[model samples]
Target: MEDNYSLYEIAVCELIRRLSNKDDCKRYHEVLGYQHRLNHYIIKCRTHGEPKEFETQFNEIISQLNRVSLLELNVSFNDICNNVSREKQDDVVKQIPFIIVAMTQSEAAKLFENYNESEKLKLLIDSISKGRKTTHFIRQLIERYAETRNKWKPFEKDSRTISDIINDLLPKLIKILFPIREEEANIDLIPDYYESAFFSSNLEERSEIRDYFIQRDCIFIVDTISLFNPEIRDRFLQSQLAATKPIIGILPISKDSMAACEIIEESIKDKFEWVYERYQRKLEYNCSLEAYSLPSFNRWLYKILPDIVKRIPQAAPENINKMKENLKYNSKGFQKVVLSMGGAK
Candidate 1:
């Protein structure tokens, strides 16, 4: 049960455990091979069949696969959640702040503008200000503000003659909102404060902020692969991978298209494969560049549930039995699985 085991391996192990007779192992292996072949067939058939006919056949095959996979694994909802939590907690050295970096300066600017126009920044400020009278609140707020600006939007608008809105406003606001001690007020650190408290001053400033987070073991989550230009993507990959912290780059691909993966590989060359292989070995899941459809994801979930159940320490016998029963009936569709797991709120 090393964390490096893939979901596929976990599912296969669970399937082996559920076999009543040891002789059935060969039959089960053959079935698994058949299912793998079927997956490839379905992928191939996607380009050939007539729209309506293909849809019907695809749905049927997916449903059948889901059923067989669930029956073979026989896991519960509580078990899946418990295992996921345990795996997740193993990495929780601290609450690693996920800084989501956009693919381009324009996108980053848009996101930053959105935060200004929207209630996000206001809400964040309000939450931080409420019910806490700690001496470090101002420092915390400054750090958060600086981090957000650097991660989301490092480039200043060329059209703007003035500095950033937050940059111009913070000093005055800090003086008005925070009671400064006499000793603190006399210190001539306004220039240094401004430099440390704001981003968009220079490229180096942005990089410094990124390095700060990396040193703290923060996870940088890049938004999407579809939006990245070659230069931006390469720089991002270089910076993120060079860091001691973990990076989770989400490639939002179409249901059955490899365009995203192709674009990524084109951008980063063999580095894409290298990162993926590293993820598979260290992160306990395959981050291989592939177009993962909804059905494929669901099938994975179905297979892994039994292994998850086995990992949960406090699972009551009756509840575990009920979960297995639910899985037997509800594993046909992802929606059914959700509903079977107490309607999923």
Candidate 2:
């Protein structure tokens, strides 16, 4: 499956999606034209026989990438976390529509496990950041947890924040765990979120829909539990669109994934249209609501890519992290799962 990458096709579609906004992805129409035509050829490759004309499409991408200074649609953890204001985070989210990978509550919990911390943080960061990649910090992360010297105690709360970790958890753990000054005990840069931010049985619990700079590097439940409620639906939608931190709902490849978005119309009183496109090989699926759009088709391609989940590579930090940065999405539950894309960042 590692060899089954549709690299050219994915790159072209990603570029085209970046150019669509007309405001931020500013470039001559030629780049956009090639993207559309390239996507057309990709769909044709799916249906009809592969076209030799694909060479022309690939060539056009290379030329435009150089001339237009190829636009990469990415929002960093620092992009939102660096800013501590409601207005600034809102502006960032507004400028770049955050991607949501809708999935089940149990899946979120599985990812929440501490054993998966190293790989989980990498996957969430890359996906929410729209394939921003670059996860060299993972090696340091494993070392930091090793310094903890004790097992990660499961906190039974619904969620946690940077404030909770730094002010409370880290200090206590650092006394015995870290081998540095308390003030300068540099924590691993593996950003994280606790359990599902929207998971609740009642409106009281549900109303705590978190969205801010604090929630910037988080992954939580985006299941139907909160999606069907009117207020929760509206809040969740707003968070996805306006929060500096991306909230992609990575749903399983089931009807629930489809209904997750469709229920938006049922909860609200508007007619929301969801447009989706099937990428090459019928393997990847991407969708978005016209009223509330995300960055790109791949942003909505939330499925675990084939071959992304496999045995952990040898204990070499630099090569492993470089391999991981390319990966956009990876499912949890593997022994040590890390995300790796087909190319360099």
Candidate 3:
């Protein structure tokens, strides 16, 4: 981001985004039509209206945003109505800071700098509502994350082979995911691409890949961001019939949020009507999802490893302690990590 955008200013924009995002502002959409009007209003704030007037509609948003941040400011409603300048209306919010406002702009920037794509994604998702009571569901999501994959079939009598298509798609996959500067998310995309290729291969070929991974005790994972490939979608639908592997998917991005999220969603939205439908079914979707991420998944594994080791009652304490120091993860990893407490003494 440019220096012209202060972290405080960015946070304010983020608040603006949340108030208009499909996931966040369903309460306001039918009434305020934020979906269609938000960008127009942003432009209006610079021209026909002043910042103070712009914030007049944000009283409820201010209250809503208060729950997500660590701050609990007690600014009066009167202060919000007054004491705002055209150039620095966000200054008023300095007293009642939202997500990034709890700290100094510099402090917030430093904190944000360390956040990976998945972490930031989680933060943005969590900030949607004031509620924070889903720890158990999150644990379940992490458990599911350790076991997931997809399957695809090749086009009949196609001039090109499945491998040829995968070879072509591989370069494009790197090209898109590399634009993401966040290293963890970028690296995570590697397994997703290879997993997609594995699914797209013939049964014999896929079995080979599956055997190798199964022997190695590796789990295949798919995160947010699939391409606009119909074959992939059809393969996914076909695979779901007898699917033993439980899969968890995240919607690409809300209609708003980070600029990067919008770009990613827009590019692939056409191919993922199923995902978009899930977002549109917001309340139901929220009920089903527990918001798991890679870091949280690792933590879940670490937390459960001690109990898992207990299952191997005959195992040496030193060996069990060593295993606890470095936990392993995947579908098979989940099977091993989630062992029973009742065993031989």
Candidate 4:
């Protein structure tokens, strides 16, 4: 029999050969095939019998493939080596981090492309929370994720609690994350765009929105109406998130229009709705989401709108002023959402 090499070993050989011949670059389909092969190869190498030979060969091939130093990949590889025991029952824990760090943003994304329900949370949590006991790290991960993908959520008028969380916690985290003077990086965590119009509100537009959220590793919180009458909005949110698995945090409204702000507190209560919490204690603030009045949120949102609008083509000069106005008006409605919660506690 042809040296019973696991699929990964064979794949490593094929990809290395392809890279050497530089053929994968020429064949577009091969690019896709290469990724599948790479994933399967990693899985096989990790779980199959005594992989020292495979690892050695894989390392040799990778050495040859190395054209540039990938800090993320190197760091991740080191992390894997420390965590896993290849000699044991395929304890491939270490490989997970390496695969995460090694792949280009696009390649890393493919790992989740075929994820089943149980597997999705692992990806989201590892990337954001890192299974650490620090809310600071988790929050920064969310913000950095937002910034990297150009998704910035301007604090809504009703997101007084969220605004407080952002303003109070964000600066402190930035200080820790960017310790050196040169390490400072401007990050935006809000969505690139937001349409209050739910799923039934638009089809093509909703799909685009879903894709946007998925790419950014984000979640959505539908307005209060969804909480009261969830049939349509819930379906809309689900349909939108079908392509991309973002947490959908639903905020319940009081329907008084004036008491709409209550949704902010309720939304935090429903934070698990955004991302499932197998262990609820792991959440920030004990998942006790605080409340920040709408004015507080709008102040920050309006401050950032000018700069944000400048980059959006759809937001023309005429529309810029209009958006600013809309933000102010929205802030009022949002404020109502927050203030309504005042009676609760």
Candidate 5:
């Protein structure tokens, strides 16, 4: 497998996926082209043929990514893995995305494991944020989990907001662990829905929700007001300050919202620098992962180019680069490599 695809092709593709948006991938698509090149260099590594589904998938994902803020697509860290994984799983070389090689094997394992478990995604994310190695099978497990997760379900309309994502998961955590509850446990005459109440944008309509929390003597939910609209950011803070007579403990910010626009613009610039930094952390993460995958492809190509050079390299320098570029860069490289090898086989 190393002889066929080369780490260069793998890594480059991973990086391109990170940088490319709908308007133009430019260098991003180049990585996919390199994947096809790898096939020509090594007989076994060549693709069987182009895949129709991949074209559709790439177009759809890239188009959506272009429309939204690039910052939001920080989740593209797993794009290369997700694309490859969507194919089939049983057959694997390292059975890990090239990025996995960047992490220690144990760290890789934890990443993959957490990635698979719904409960562990937050924990895994926290670990990654802290720069901790949370697993050993990161690479292999990424391949398995990426494919498993990519079995596309329709997008839920409610999932458009950051709050929606948290709401979907938070309730499950509440049910099983019961980690957070009121200090003085009391069965309320009316249910406590303070979390939802405070975020209401309509000032006139928020009276009921504000009264609900005050009635419960809840001082703050820790950064809860950070989720409010920009127009109301200050208003919410002022109201909360006035309403809570005695200053209490800190409010907890939702982990997901930490990277949100509201939080980023309003965040303590020094403490959470990544939130405000010019570089997109997600894109950087993807690039780092791809950097790790490159050497493997280089190692593979080092072995195979001798044979192919006679026909291809001898033909034209432009052809060589184009072939290599396509194999290693383009989305079709996935199928291109297989077909390239199948023709040789």
Candidate 6:
């Protein structure tokens, strides 16, 4: 049986060789344009005689051309690898902020575990105020916490009220965190709102104050007078417009302060709208007065003091304390009210 199988394989191999040779001959004749001319010459030679000289010369020329074209195209493997690496790096850079933002609450907790709550809060606030690319992610984390749990409350000191802690630490913290630069716009506190005679004086007398307001990038109105009186509100709005400076009004609220609050709200809306139209730009005007009662205001102060510190990078303890003293003196015996504008919401 083995011998018979071997004989069959030999016969099939011989048959395949014959068929392959026949196909190759047919293909060689048909494939090349020069094959037709060669075939015609071959037929002529069969009928007449061989052209030895021309055939030898053509063969030699084809051999020389083949030898000349032997060099393969060069490729730089290193260059290709380097280009791919550069593209990958750029993609990673773009994704970094998003990756940070997408971290789970547990992941964020672990990332910040080394720092105390105050330190973590400070870092977050700093990251936000510096307009770091990572700010959006940080904000997302905060919002997520707010949604799932309550807002992340800061660690309180045992001896001091949150307000007192803020008053003591905020100014120094801001100065340390964000140093003043010559190119940066000034951040000024309107320490005593009553001392600003711009509202009572004519436009001419307020030129210096107007110019001062114009040059600043941010102004903190610490007093409550500007919010209630229409004329003072108009002047404040005008100053902001002249320089495109942002004003943060902090008003202490009380039972009798409703009218003032209404006036302030209207003034804010009017000014914001006017600015939007004049500049052909949209602006956001947010007031949280509705959400704040006296007790709630104290809590709000605790929650927002970090943000306020971030915004007013130039806040100094001396300036803040001076404002507080002036406020105390001017108020006589009214309950402390809190109103703030323009910071993280």
| Candidate 3 residue pairs in clash (backbone atoms < 3 Å) | none
Best by lDDT: 1
- The positional error of residue 230 in candidate 4, measured at the CA in angstroms, is 3.1
- Alpha carbon lDDT of each predicted model: 0.37, 0.33, 0.33, 0.34, 0.31, 0.34
lDDT of 1 by residue, 72-158 (tens): 334542355444433333110111133444433453334434433535333432343454553344333222222232333211222
Give the poorly placed runs of model 5, Cα more than 4 Å off: 1-164, 167-204, 217-230, 241-345
- Per-residue accuracy of model 6 over 178-219 as CA lDDT, tens digit each: 454322312332322212334435676566655654543322
Which lDDT value does model 4 have at 122?
39
Q: Report the CA-based lDDT of candidate 4 relative to the real structure.
A: 0.34
| Candidate 3 weakest lDDT stretch, 10 residues | 92-101
1-345 per-residue lDDT for model 5 (tens digits): 353453434543454445555366665455455445433433432354444444444445445435445554445535554445333222211100010101223333454444545333444344334443534323322332221111111121221222222223323322232233332111111111233334445666567655644543332222221222232344345355323221111112223433422333344233323322322343321111111122332233233322322222122334434544432433312211111221211
Which runs of model 4 end up more than 4 angstroms from their true locations?
1-169, 181-193, 197-200, 221-226, 235-237, 240-345
- The TM-score that candidate 2 achieves is 0.21
How much lDDT does candidate 5 score? 0.31
Clashing pairs in 6: 251-339, 252-337, 252-338, 253-337, 253-338
Worst 10 residues of 1 by lDDT: 186-195
| Candidate that would win on TM-score | 1
lDDT of 2 by residue, 1-345 (tens): 123436445544554545555664445465577666776766777676666667666666656555344332233222232222221111100011122223233333333333234443333334333333334332222222211111111111213221232223322322433344432221221212332344344445434554343433333223222233344455455444223232233221123334433443333323111211222123223222221222221333232212111221222344334433432224321111112222111
- The ten-residue window of minimal lDDT in model 4 covers 92-101
